[model samples]
Target chain A: MSLIAVVDYGMGNLRSVDKALEHVARDGQEVRITSSADEILAADRVVFPGQGAARDCMRELESRKLIEPVMQAAKEKPFLGICMGLQVLLAHSEENDGVDCMGLYPGNVRFFGKVLNQDDPAEPLKIPHMGWNNVNQTIDHPLWQGITDGSRFYFVHSYYVDPEERSIIAGETTYGIGFTSAIACDNVFAVQFHPEKSATDGLKLLENFTHWDGK
Target chain B: MSLAKRIIPCLDVDNGRVVKGVQFVDIRDAGDPVEVARRYDEEGADEITFLDITASSDNRDTIVHVVEHVAEEVFIPLTVGGGIRKIEDVRTMLNAGADKVAINTAAVFNPEFVKEATDRVGSQCIVVAIDAKQVSAEGEPLRWEIFTHGGRKPTGLDAVEWARKMVDYGAGEILLTSMDRDGTKIGFDIPLTHAIAEAVSVPVIASGGVGNLEHLAEGIIDGMADAVLAASIFHFGEFTVHEAKQHMAKRGIEVRL
Candidate 1:
């Protein structure tokens, strides 16, 4: 029986994430929403899901004493990050002036403030970029199993991750400009959209994660 | 991919069962909220909204149960409205698996509640539902007035002005429903929706008066709504969510089909 711990550092709605994991869990598989570092480290897999400001997310992770455990889990186990969870793994973020993150991936998170469609520059895209958008898979990864190449997922964030290593980007989506939508390297898989709220394809992705091994 | 307009199916619930009514009167039973929500999720609805029409003290628990049941099966953003009076109420809805909560009466009674809830839970989850009706006088220009209690009473607050104020108070999205147009299915109050959409920086969901796919498209193209919300059109099976999306896609509106 594999245990999947959804790391909750008192930010975002962790319940829906937990519920989605529970829905896909098999007979012996267990999903737990935990903030405890020990529980997170002991789990067979870790799912880090977060939303809110980058500075606040950093503060909560530090205050809850989860920084080391999260870093270790990303390296040791099959780790999945969602939205702000993906952003906090970066080196720095442009949110709230500028905030230093975990530096798990060598990149910076950028704000899409003036992102205008190339076709129509007069009509500027909205901030927060809230809605379902297509994610074009860039590289073959275990998490992309069963999911289509250009499946749409629900995204609700103003910032997008700019990873240094292009080879690690598993998926890319366009929102006025092309941006990295999903990143994968080793055991780590992170997405800018909410798979829990992405419907059929999203559920398939979560189901894939439950069976994914840290290869 | 960024600016795809949304098609949302709204479930107006009374007690634990989903119900449909005309102008908030003569309510007719639809089905179980959980079952309906699941079907919509499978049907590819962009989002699902639940409004507890009979928001009594006792039925609150039932709504919570409905939210939990739907959230378990349906993996989409769920917005719950009705009977939400305080921040604690918003917390209860969110804890019950609602991604966002819509506030109407309480927000008008105490405008600061919007800021307070937004500050605590973040604006992404706080939605301000404005039930508006166009009001005119001899000297004054046409203005939409905010209504409450299922559009039974007016608060005298200008809808366009209130929408801006709510956004300034940290409301992430605005659900603007026209009292005169709701349940009529003539089409959304385009002028009212256009005014609010232009006034607010945040996304505005055009609710009320959607009869067909064309009306839904009109909400996006003409009303300038970021999302088009309809009840009877989707609930009564007049148009499937997929069909509506296909129609929108053909009409040059980007939609996930």
Candidate 2:
């Protein structure tokens, strides 16, 4: 029996994430949304899900005194970071002028320019890159067990991460340019797309996360 | 691979029950919005939009229950539109597990509502729904005027300029629906959709007037819409979301199959 602590920082839809996890969680594997440092530290796995601006996410985590517990949990067990959860792992973000992040991984978050696909002026590339896009598996990881090499995941964001060490990059997706979509190293596995909302392929990643021992 | 064009099935809910005028197909319980949402999610629908057409404001809270049940089961992104006039309304929908809230008449009545929403909530959750009707006569300069109150009232606003203004006002996305072709089942207003999509930097969801799968793909191909939304086609079981994706893919448009 293991506990999965979903860090609740009052950003985005924490309910859906919790429900999706509970849907796939095996029997006796408890899943709870908690800001309690003790529960987070005691959990077998941690899922940090973020939404909204990077500045606001940091502020909420700092205000709730969750930063320490989240960092500790990431270092301790199998951790999954999603969307802003993945962005905040980097050193800094270009959004909201600039915002400092957890620095769990060395990377800088940069914005997608106003126009994407400059070659095709006919299609005015929508910002926030809001749609289903393919994520090419760059490394052989446990999470890619059933998901195809270029499976599409739901993504909605203006900024993408750039890890200081490229080896940490696990998945790459092409929007305007190929950016790091998923990153993994040791016990940590983070994704810029919301696997909870990514349908069948997404559920497969979560299922893999449940079975991964963080090798 | 590039970003795949999205296909969204919209549900019109009136007083908590999915309106039965269009989606009268074999959905076990056709009135149940959650059942319908789950069906679409299983069939490979990229997203689901709930257009709350609740006539009375008192019964507006019913839509929240519907969203709560659907979001509880369905994992895909959920968008809630209709009767979003106040910030509290936006919060209620988001709290109900909606990934996005489309502000239609409220944003048209007061453009400041869009900015206030973006400031209060993130722009990502705020989608501006524009219902515009072609006002230009055939053979004349192409132009459309914004229509409010379900295409009954004219706001005297230029549809394309208003879309740009909303984007600048911090709207993350625009849901453009053609009032003229809404129920005709012929197709979407291609030029109108093409105009607004070209005008805005945010993703535009082309809605209304989708009789068949070809109409859905046309929005992405010629109109350049980031996503295509329809109700009657899928609800009536004429075609599935899989069929729509296959049709778009064969047409050379990238779609998740």
Give the winner by lDDT.
2
lDDT digits (tens) for residues A1-215 of candidate 1: 78999999989889899988888888899999999999999999999999788889999999999999999999999999999999999999998999999999888899887454333533446556888999999988888988889889999888899999888899999987999999999999999999999988888899999999967
TM-score, cand. 2? 0.97
Evaluate residue B115 in candidate 2 and report its C-alpha lDDT on the 0 to 100 scale: 96
Range of the 10 consecutive residues with the lowest summed lDDT in candidate 1 chain A? A115-124
Query: Candidate 2 residues A36-132, lDDT tens each?
Result: 9999999999999999899999999999999999999889799999999999999999999999999998879998883364747766567898889
Query: Cα miss at A11, model 1 (Å)?
Result: 0.7
Clash statistics: count for each candidate: 0, 0
B137-252 per-residue lDDT for model 1 (tens digits):
65777788999877889888888899999999999899999999998989999989988888887889999999989999999988888999999988667778999999999899
- Model 2 chain A worst lDDT window (10 residues): A114-123
Give the DockQ-based CAPRI class for model 2: high
Worst 10 residues of 2 chain B by lDDT: B20-29
TM-score for the A chain of candidate 1: 0.97
Clashing pairs in 1: none
- Candidate 2: residue A134 lDDT (0-100): 92
lDDT of 1 at A31: 96
The residue-level lDDT of candidate 1 at B123 comes to: 84
